[model samples]
Target: MARWHRVFRRWVLARHYRFAREALVPHFFDALTAYALELSRLGVPHAKEAVAALRELRTLPLPSFTGEVEDVFFSIEAQLLEHWGEEVAGALRRGLSRNDLDLTVFRAYLKDRALLLLGDLLRLRKALLARARAHFGVPLVLSTHHRPAQPTTLDHYLLGVEALLARDTERLFRALSGMDRSPLGASALAGNPYPVDRRRLAHLLGFAGPVEHTLDAVASGDYALELAAALALLGTSLTRLATDLLRWAEAGAFLVGESLAQGSSFMPQKRNPVVLEHARIYAARLLGGVGTLLALNHNTPFTDLNDHSTGVLEPLSELLEAGEGALELLWVALEESQFVEERLLSELSPEVMASEAVDLLVRKGLPLREAYARVKAALPGVRPETLGVEREELLHWMGLEGFFARREVLGGAGPRARAEALSEAERRLKEDQKRLGALRARVRAARFLLARGLEDPQAEEGQEGEVG
Candidate 1:
C-alpha cells in the first residue's frame, strides 16, 4: 500500500500539487461555502454538517496532506468524509466537479496575475512618457531601411513606442475582461442538476457573473490563447524598440548611463549596452512562450481535457512575470540613456531636406523632374538661397528644426503635436488607472465577503436572504 501510494504520488501529483494548492485552496473553500449555502437553501437534511466540514477543512494545514493525497480537492473530500461522514460529505459534491472548479480557480489566479501584468505595462508606459518629455524637441534623424529618411524629435519616437505599448495594455485588459464570467457551476462538461445559484458563486468568487453556456465554460481556453498572442505582439514591439536602441548605441547616436552598461572582462574600454540586449532576449522568450501556449491548445480536445487544465497553465504566469521584467528593464534603460547631440547632428545630411526643396522648386514653377535633378546635383552644399529663394524666406525649410515645424499636423513630429500627444497619454493613463482600480476594488470586496462566509456561513445566508 505504501509503495502504491508512492507511485501514484510520483506519477500524478508531485509536479503540480503545490501550484494547485496555492491557486485553488481559497477558491475551493469559497466553493464549499457556496455549495453549503445552496444545499441549505434547498433544505437538505445535512447542510449544517457540510458547513461544519468546510470549517474543519479550512483549519487543516494544506501541506500536511502533501503525499497523503493526489490532489487538494480529493484531499478535502477525504477530510470532509472523515469529519462529517459520507452523508454530509456527499452533499459538498452535488453541484461541483474538478472541471469547473479548476477553471474557476484558474480564473481567480489569472485575474490577479493579469492585473499585475497590467500594472507593469502601465509603469512602462509612464516611463516611456517621461523619457519623451525629457527629450522633447531634441532632434534626431529618423531612418527608414537604414538610411536617413526624415528629421524628428526624440520625444516623437518615444511617444510612438508608448502608442504600441498602449495597444498591449488594451489587449491585456481584453484578456482580463474575458475572464470576468465564472465557470463554477459548470460541473464536468455540462452542469449539475441540483439547485445552484451560479450568480452567487460568481459573486463570492470575484467573477463579474456566471458564464452562460455550461459546456463552453468548461471547454474554452481562448482567453489564455488571446492573452498569449497579445503578449507576443507586445514582446515583438519591445524587441523592435530594443533593436533600435542597440543600433543607435552602436552608432554613437545614443549613450547608455554607466549603471545600464556592462563591461567585457577582457576589454578595458568596453561599455556594452547589454540591458537592451537582455531586453531583446527576453522578448524572444516571450514569443517562444506564446508559441508553446498556442501549440498546447491547438490540437487538443475542447472540454476539460489535460491540455487545457490548471497544470498546463502553470508556466503562463511566469511568462507574464518575464514580460513585466523585460518591460521594466527596458524602461529603466531608456530612462537612464541620453542621445548624443553631436553624433546625431553629424548624421543629418543636407540631402535629407531634398523633399522640401523639391516642393519649393515646384512652387517656383519648375517641373517636378527638373526639380529632382536640381536637388540631386546640389547635394553637398545645398542651401535654399542657392535655388533662387531669399535666405530668410527659405530658412523655414532648411534645418532639422525647420523640418520638424513643416510637418505640424496632428500626430506629427512638431513641438505642439508632441505636447498634445503627451497630454492625451496622461489623460488616457488616468482613465486606465481608475478603471483598473475599480476592478481591484471589486475583487477585494468579493474576497472580503468570502472571508466572512468562511468565518460564519450563516452571516452570508442572512445577507443572501435579505437580497432575495
Candidate 2:
C-alpha cells in the first residue's frame, strides 16, 4: 500500500536511480531486474540461492514486493558477495552500464517480436493461398476504377496478393536471422575485463553469436525498425486486398459469394463491410509506425535510440491486431465469396474484344493505328463477343477468342501461372506455417504481443503439407 514515490525512494531511487520512470517501467522491466540479479549471480556464486532461501518468493524487480524480495537480494549479497551484511550495498564503477544492458535486452526482445510478426504474416499468406485455390477457375469480372473492365479469375487476383506476401515472409525471416545475434557482450561499448562470456549469454538467449561491434550493438535498433517497416508494408498489402473485397462485395454485382456483412443499428438493409473498413483504417495506422520510427531516428543517432522504441507501440499494436483477425476473416470471406459468372459474362462486349478486333484488322492488311482507330470507334463500354465480329474464327484469329487463351503469355493471366501461382502460394503457405510457428516461439520468449486468429486459416481442409 506504499505510494510510488515512497517505493521509488526506498527501494529503487535512494541513490544512483538517474532514469525516467517511464523508461524504467514496461512489461519487460521485471525481466531487466532479473537480468540484473543474473549479473549479480556472476560475481556471487550462492547469491541467487541465498536470496531464494530467504523466501523472497520471486526473482524479479517488484517495488511492491520489495519487503520480501529486496530483503532476500540483500541477504544473498550479504551471505555470498558481501561480508555477511558488513558490506550490504555498493556501486561498481567499471564494466557494463545499465544503458548497455537496455540496448542488449531490447535488441533481443525486438528480434523475438519480429519473428512472431513474421509467423503471423505467414499464416495470412496461407489463408490467401487456400482461398486462391478454391476460386482460380471460378470466373469473375476484373474491375478497374470500380467498373467491370476485363475477364479475370479469382485465382489470378489472389496470386498477386500471394506473390507480395511471399516476398514479405522472406523479408521477415531475413530480418530475424540478421538481427538474432546477442548484444550482451558489448557491455559498455568496449569489452569488459571481467571475462564475461558473451557467447554463453547468446547461447542462453538462442542467438547465433555475440554482436561483432560493441558500439554498433549499442546503436542499432535499425533491425527492429526495418522489421516494423516490413510488417507495415505487409499489413498495407493485406489491407489493400481487404479494402478491395469490401468495395467489390458491397457493389452487389460481385455477389458471386455470400456476403460477409451485418445489419446496421438504424437500418435493416445495411450489410456493412465493417471488418474491411477497419482494416483500411489500421493499414494506414500501421504505415504511420514506419514513418514515426524513421523520424525518431532522423534527429538522433541511428543506434538504439529511446525515441525509436517509444514511437513504435501504436503502429505495431495496430498491425499485430489487424493481422491476427483480418487475415482469417478475409480468408473466410474469400472462400465464401463466389465468382459471379453473369457479371463476368456481361463483360464479354466486343469492345473488351477490341484488342482482338485490332489484331483482326492487322491480319486483314490494315495498319496498326487504323486497326486501333476502327476498334476505338467500336467501344465506349462493352465486353468481348459484343463487338461486330460475328465469326468465331475472326475473333479466334484476333486472339480475343477465350479469356484464358488470350492470357497464355509467360506471366499473363494464363491458367497455368494462375494455377502455378496458387500452387506456389500454397507451398509458401506451408513454409509460412512452419516459419510462423518458429517465429511465435521466438516472440513468446520475449514479450506478449501475440495476435489473435492467426491459427486455423485453412483448417477445414488439410493444408499442412499442401500449398505449392
Candidate 3:
C-alpha cells in the first residue's frame, strides 16, 4: 500500500473501528447471538456451536485488526475466522452481509447517542424553566429588529426560549422514532433466505421493531439525516439565545459569573462572556455538520452507498457531542449567571411603554390609526400635556409595571396573562419531563434484556420488550 493509503487504514479506519468497538460492537454481537439462537431453533447446522463460540468470543478481549481491506467489518470477520475457525465464523455469517450489519450497528449507535443528547437537552430545559420561574415578573425591555419595542418580564422572554426548545425536543423525539426500527435481517439490501426472526433480532437489540422493506432497511439514510437536521434546528435556537445573552452581557443587564467570564489580558475593564461565545461556536459546528451530511448524501445512489452510511457517522457523532457540550455550557450560564435587574430597568427607554399609550387613546374611541399617529407625534417624550391626558394617568400608563398591568388580554404582558403563561409553561415542562423519563425507562429495560440475552443467548427467547 502507498504511504497515505497505509496511513488512512491505520488512522481513519482504525478510529472508526474504535468508535464501533465502544458504541455498537456489543450490540452487533448481541444480534449475532440472537441469530445463532434463532438458527438453532430452526435446526440449522452448526448453529449450536456458533452460539457457544460467540459466547467465548465475547469473553475474550476484542483484538485489533487493521487488515489491507480497510473495512472494519472485514477486519472483525478476519479476526473471527482466525480465532474461532471457519465453521463457527461461517455459521455466524450465514445469511448476513456487511451492508445490513453495518447499517444496523450505525442505527444502534445513533440511537444510543440520541438518548444521551436527549438527556442533556432535558437538563438544559429544566435549568431554563427554573431560571424562568426565578425571574418571573422581573421587567426588561423587549427588542425587535435590534431596537427596543416594548416592555416584557424576564420570565416571558425565557419562556419564549423554552417554547422554541420545546419544539426542538419534539423534533428530536420524532427523529428517534424514525430510527427505532432495526435493519438486521435485511441482508445486503435484499431479504435474507434463512428463517431468521427479524422481530426477535430487533427485540434483542433494543429496537422497537424491524424495518418492513428489506431494501429500505439498508438503503434509507433518512433517519440519520432527520437527527442531524433536528440538531441543527436546536443549534439555531441555542445560537439565538447565546446571541441574546452576549448582547445582555455587553449591556451590563446580565452578569456572567466571574468564573465563567474571561478577563482581557491588556484591557483593565474588559470581561468577556466567553462561555456564550464558546456555546455559539459549538452551535455553529452543529449547523456546519448538518450541511456536510446533507451534501454527502446528495447525488449519491440511494441503495446502501457508503456515502450515506459509514461516511456520515463521524460527522454526525461530532455534531451530537458538540450539541451536548453546548447544552451543558448554556445550562451552566443560565443557572450561574445573574440578571442585573436595576440595570435592566434603568436601561429601558421610557418610550418602550408607548404601546400602552397608544392603546389608551384607542380605548377612548379614537381610531387605531389615529391613536398610533398621536403617539408617534409625541416624539421621544410623551408628556401628559402633549398627549392631552392627566400627568398621573400618563405616568401610570408609561410605567413598566403599569404597562404590564393593562395588557391583561390572553398572551399579553399583563399580570393575569403572565400568570397564565407561566402556569402553561410549568404544565408543559412537567409533561416533557414525564415523557423523557418514560423514554429513558424504556431504553433501560431494553438494554437490560439485551445484556441478559448476551449472558445466555436463549434467556430472552419468547420474551417481550420494546424500545424507541
Candidate 4:
C-alpha cells in the first residue's frame, strides 16, 4: 500500500474500526465490512475467539455460508475478542445504526477539512498583508459609478479586500461552530434500544456535545446548509474582488503593473488580465457548487441519501478542493502585481474625495446637504460640475489635518482603525494557530499509531473528549 493508505489504514485499525466492530458484534449483518477497520479498534476481549468462530464458518466443510455478505467489521471484532478480554456487544447492540454512524463520520471528516482550510486562510491573510505593506503609501485611484472619483493610497485600496477576507474568516468560524454536535445515539430515526452513552460517543468523535435528541441528530443537516450559505457569500465577495481587479487592471486604467502576456495562435499580441479572469470564473464556480448542493438535497427525506449530512459528499469535496486551490493561487497573484496608480489617479480625480470636502465644508458651518452641493459644484466636471483647481493642491487638501482625523472614527479608514484592524487580525492569527497546532497534533498522533502497526481498537483519546 502507499504510505498514506497505510497510515489511513492504521487509523482505521485503531479508532474507527473498533467503534464499528463494537457496534456490530454479531456476524449476522451483511453490509458491516464497511466498518471492519473500526472493529479492530474496539479491542473486545472475545475478539480472537469471535475471529476463530467466523473463520470456521468460512472454512466449514458444508454449504452453510451461501450469501457472500460483507461482515469484516463485525468479524474482526469477533476475532479479536479474546485479545481484549472484555466485550461490549451488549451495549453496542442497543445504541447505533448505519445512519447515525455515517453522520458521525461526516462530522469527523468536516472537522479535519476545517483545519485544512484554516491553513488556506492563514496564507490568504498573509497575501493581503504583504500587498498592504509593500504598497502602503503608493497613490492609486478610487472609483464609484464605474468612473474614477478621487485618489487614495494603493495600499489603502487593498484595505477593502483585507476587510472582506477578514469577514469571510469570521463567517467560516461561525459556520464551523454550528457543526460541533454528535449524532451517534440517533440511530436511523428514533434511537438505539440501549442506554448507550450518546454523549460519550460524541466525546469519542471529538464533538462539543451530543445532538440533543435522536431525530435531530439523524435529521439535522444545518451544518452543511449554513456552510454552503457562508461559502456562497464568500464566493460572492471573491467575485466582487475579482471584478475590481479585472476592471482596474485594464490597459487603460494601468493601475496594476503586470506583463500578463502570451502569444495566441492567430493574434500577434495577446496580453490579458488572465489572473483576474481566472479568479472571476473560479469564484462563479465556487458559488455554483454551493448552489448545486442546496438543490441536490432540497427535497430529500429528512435523513435521506442526498443530504449525507450535507447536500452531497461529492459536491462538498469539490468545493473544498477547488475553493482552496483557487484562493491559494490568488495569494500568489496578489503578491505579484504591483499597484500602478498614476493612471488610476488620472481617472479617480481629486473630486472622488468630495465627501471629505463636504465634511470639511460641513465642519466650516454649512448644513450637510448644502456643504455637499457646494463642494460638488466647486470640485469637477459638467457631469460632476468641475472647478479649475490644480490636482496637487486638491490632493493635499483632501488629506488636510482635520479630514484624516475626523474620518478615522470607529471603523472608518482612519489611521487608528487601520492599526486596530491589523492588530485584531494578528491576534486572531495567533489564536487560530494555537488551535491548528492542537488539531495537527491529534492527526499526527493518529498517524504515528498507524505507522507502528500496533494499535488496539479503542475510543478516541485527546483534548476533544470529556472522558478519555
- The C-alpha TM-scores of every prediction are 0.88, 0.72, 0.91, 0.70
Model 1 alpha-carbon miss at residue 20, Å: 1.8
lDDT of 4 by residue, 1-468 (tens): 233355545543333344333332222221122122233234433333333344334332221211222223344334334333345332233334767766766665665666677678667777776676666555565667877655545555666676777778778777767766766667787886543455544543445677887887777676777777767777787788778777766644533325543446787655566777776676677687666767766776775652344335446656766667657656656766655645555654455567766665565677998766767677463122333345554455576343445557654555676556566656766776676677567545543433232232454432321111
- What stretches of model 4 exceed 4 Å from their correct place? 1-96, 251-263, 303-311, 341-344, 355-371, 378-396, 399-406, 440-468
Candidate 2: which stretches are off by over 4 Å? 1-96, 145-147, 253-260, 301-319, 322-329, 335-348, 380-390, 394-401, 436-468
lDDT of 3 by residue, 1-468 (tens): 343466776677777777776666776766677677666666676776777776667666665644454555566567678877887677778888777788888887788888888888888878877887888888887689988887788888887888899899999999998888888888888788786778877766667788989998888788888999999999999999999999989889889988899999999899899999999999878888768878888887877464347678888988999999899999999888999987776647647777888888888888999889888888687766777888798777678777777789887777788778778877887887787777667657656654444433543455332211
Better of 1 and 4 by lDDT: 1
* CA-RMSD of model 2: 10.3
RMSD of each: 3.7, 10.3, 3.9, 9.4
Backbone clashes counted, model 3: 0
Write out the backbone clash pairs for model 3: none
Q: What is candidate 2's TM-score against the reference?
A: 0.72
TM-score of predicted structure 4: 0.70
Poorest lDDT segment (10 consecutive residues) of candidate 3: 459-468
- Model-by-model lDDT, in order? 0.77, 0.54, 0.79, 0.56
Candidate number with greatest lDDT: 3
TM-score ranking from best candidate downward: 3, 1, 2, 4
Q: Please report the candidate that would top TM-score against the real structure.
A: 3
Candidates arranged by lDDT, highest first: 3, 1, 4, 2
Q: Model 1: per-residue lDDT, tens digit, 326-363?
A: 88788788778888866765667767767888787888
In lDDT terms, how accurate is model 3? Answer: 0.79
Worst 10 residues of 1 by lDDT: 459-468
Give the per-residue Cα lDDT of candidate 1 at 197.
71
Clash numbers, per candidate: 0, 20, 0, 35
lDDT digits (tens) for residues 209-294 of candidate 2: 66777777766667667766776776778778877776565655444233666668899876676656655665555666667667
